[model samples]
Target: MQTQRNRRGYIQHFINCKHLWLNELKKLAHDLKNPYLLKENVPEYPRPEFHVSHLKHDTERGALCWIRTDGGFKDPHRGFRDPHKWSLVWWSLAVGPEEIKAAETRLLEKTYPNQTKEQAVKQQSFLWRFATSPAFSEKSRYGSYRFTFPLQDVLSAYSQQFCFGAPPIMRVFRTCLFKKKVQYSVLVHSPANRELFSEFPLLPGNDPNAVCAYRDGRFIWRSEAMCETHRY
Candidate 1:
């Protein structure tokens, strides 16, 4: 009876071991078949060639850098083609207010045209959306203006101007209340969703109108007349 009991115990132990081994083998086979299951095979670093660049200032969350890809800013009618390469790199720099002001002046002078009467109206209307919106008022004491650009166009422009090395494009959007206090904002987009521009809060009771300002690209606001009222 003792010998029979020992044999039965050994058989049960052997069966359990075999079952365990088979289960492990099945798992190994499944993993091998699905290579994506191995994290090591995945890319650890972000690939910049196909991403957008989003950088912000260290001191002011409002200050931003929107570096366009090579050949991104040219007119499409001028035989512009999408590079299909998108990459985004972000960095922060600590700078003084004067430096920020100087940079803003330079960028505006270089990129934005003189504000026309129509343009002024458009901006005011845009600003009014934030001022009038109850939702905006509840969020915070300040407001921001956000700009969105087509990534392909920006990159194309960057490539043509700077062949080997180029300084990143940094644009500042400033909104003020009572012409005394200013709120800052930055423009940003992700590599995964480069097709659409993100939304930011505008002034309250502003009409939804799209206006292309010669000085500041295209701005979509509530209406031309409302924008004019808010002009300084």
Candidate 2:
């Protein structure tokens, strides 16, 4: 499809401009804390994805990159089940939430008949509640909220957020996804580079062991478990 080609072109552009973004990429790789997370000399184009956040009451722009893997395991799934396993990196910029809110708001205004400020706010509230509620939480399901943010709008927001604005070159140190209940992860810094960031406070936004999960319209992010109990 033309859209796929255009996105691929974006990746090519990223490769062409690697000099401008490589440091940022290294920063992200360092934050992973998993030395084996990235295979050597493997840089893939990052694809933008849309993520909805009930906590922020807005949608967000995030990215996914498929890279080669190095880790191995006994179980096929436990190991790098797919080529994109260990090298798979998903990240959202720290500034993504705010920008996405602005973009979504702008989109809502242009797509439908103009509404008074009060009406618009009320509708947004309804959409959030409807989308997050148990009955209609699934994003693929049809719903009125779907009209508020279409694929076109999401892609437009992605362009404005990344292409026109600063790209999410830095990895959010600690990222979380929410499922039914909010799950939090223990704070951890990579021993690999602890000396470099030793003075930094350990927080979800900057912790390197963090992994992202998505379930029931929620994202739970957690970092390395220092102990056996913490693993549970």
Candidate 3:
């Protein structure tokens, strides 16, 4: 238990740095935060049979990381392997579920601006139903965080240029899945359901958004906004 606590402390200190934002693994370790970050993961074990938290209670919790795989399908449109890779869905666990619902409403209206009021409202609710479930909220071990983003979702993007300043501002939907075995990493930008860019051969810009990205047109990826971003 002491070892676990110490590890969490080490991770927390490293994650709080903006200078290492470009380091993918460290970036994700930071974004997911602690507690769960310390406990989540069972790569050696297969699906539905992995570790699960036995504890259960009715209370708001922290953000949960939802991971999904794509049967190793090959993407034909890009020169990168990440777009065709696995993804993680960042969903609310116990923290401010109400606020999340409200944000979903706004995103619905923005995404489907031309839809009728009724359609937009329904869409927002629909997104909320699946996106914010408390599946693993009370798990004393692993929560229901094995959520997947579809193949069409561009949750992450690549930037060839390495930025010198702080990391980009992360959105609420953005989360990560750390592959300890590989020690390499990928970021899952849930809004687009794709990587911010591909790793095949990144263009220069230092800015993740400025470089030529696979899913560049989205509003969140458009503005030069980033988090400390949320905690650098």
Which has the greatest TM-score? Answer: 3
Q: Kindly give the number of clashing pairs for every candidate.
A: 43, 8, 32
- C-alpha positional error of residue 136 in candidate 1 after TM-score superposition, expressed in Å: 26
Q: After superposition, how far is residue 215 of candidate 2 from its true place, in Å?
A: 26
Error of 1 at 182 (Å): 2.2
| Candidate 2 global lDDT | 0.30
Task: Write one digit per residue (lDDT tens) for candidate 1, span 1-232.
Answer: 0011121122111111011222232354343343322224322221110012221212122232221333222232232221222233322212223332333344344455785656544542222231332212222222242333453444455545553334223222222111121112233332333233323322222232211111132221211121112323
**Cα lDDT, all candidates:** 0.26, 0.30, 0.29
Model 3 residue runs over 4 Å out of place are 1-13, 19-94, 122-124, 132-232
| TM-score for all models, in order of appearance | 0.16, 0.20, 0.25
Residue 41 in model 3: shift from native, Å? Answer: 19
Give the alpha carbon lDDT tens digit for every residue of 1-232 in model 3. Answer: 0111121123212221112222344335454553333443313210111111111222122323111143222223233322334333222222234433554565555666788867764652432333222332233323333333222232222221222222333322221222221111213322232255433232222354331122332211111111101111
For model 2, residues 78-169, the per-residue Cα lDDT tens digits are 32532224222222212133433543465466666667878886764212211232322334222222223332343345446445632212
lDDT (C-alpha) at residue 21 in model 3: 21
